[model samples]
Target: MNVIKRATAPTPKFFKLLRNIGLSIAAAGGALMTAPAGLPHGLVTFANYLIVAGTILSAVSQITTLNDE
Candidate 1:
């Protein structure tokens, strides 16, 4: 009897990059929220957008990566 195995494909590189960037953006957004003086209204709005976008990107990356397994 003979057995054979096939190697799986590696994860795409951009997903990892997306996850790291998303984390950094989210952290920056959180830091803005915690500043003592508080950020300007426009900047706060931008920070909120960043956090949302980052969370979305991170979730997408995670779901896609898991599916590849």
Candidate 2:
């Protein structure tokens, strides 16, 4: 017996690009946060904010990308 796989729906390329960019930003933010030397209070706060925002954007983009049904 043979079975074939098929996609019931498809995602647009732009959504995939947006998702990848958001994830890359998240990686950059994480690297900044875990620096060997601690960052100043204000800069630390800003970096933390970027991490959070980037994570949220990544989640949203992934959801959009996977919303095909």
Candidate 3:
């Protein structure tokens, strides 16, 4: 019963999407960081936020994937 229960559980597709989105976001943030100075002040803040968010999402995805297996 325990084996059957585990086998019947649905794998989360959302986590894969989250991981991809996170990679894109982090890449965008990195690209933004490479721009020349004199850019808008908020850009850096936004970029930093994206980087952090991406990192978190990627980490969550990896952790969940590992546990799921």
lDDT of 2 by residue, 35-68 (tens): 9897888877877887887788766655553443
- Candidate 1 TM-score, true structure as reference: 0.71
Candidate 3's C-alpha lDDT?
A: 0.74
Kindly list the per-residue Cα lDDT of model 1 for residues 1-69, writing each as its tens digit.
111111132335787788788888888888887778957899989889988988888766644432333
Model 3 scores worst on lDDT over the 10 consecutive residues at 60-69
Candidate 2 accuracy as lDDT: 0.68
lDDT of 1 at 57: 80
- The all-Cα superposition gives candidate 2 an RMSD in Å to the true structure of 6.4
- Order of the predicted models by TM-score, top scorer first: 1, 2, 3
Candidate 1 vs 3: which has more TM-score: 1
RMSD of every candidate to native, in Å, equals 8.2, 6.4, 7.0
Candidate 3 ranges beyond 4 A from true positions: 1-12, 66-69
Q: Quote the positional error of residue 7 for candidate 1 in Å.
A: 20
Q: Which scores greater on lDDT, model 1 or model 3?
A: 3
Please name the candidate that would achieve the greatest lDDT relative to the true structure: 3
How much is 19 displaced in model 1, in angstroms? 0.7
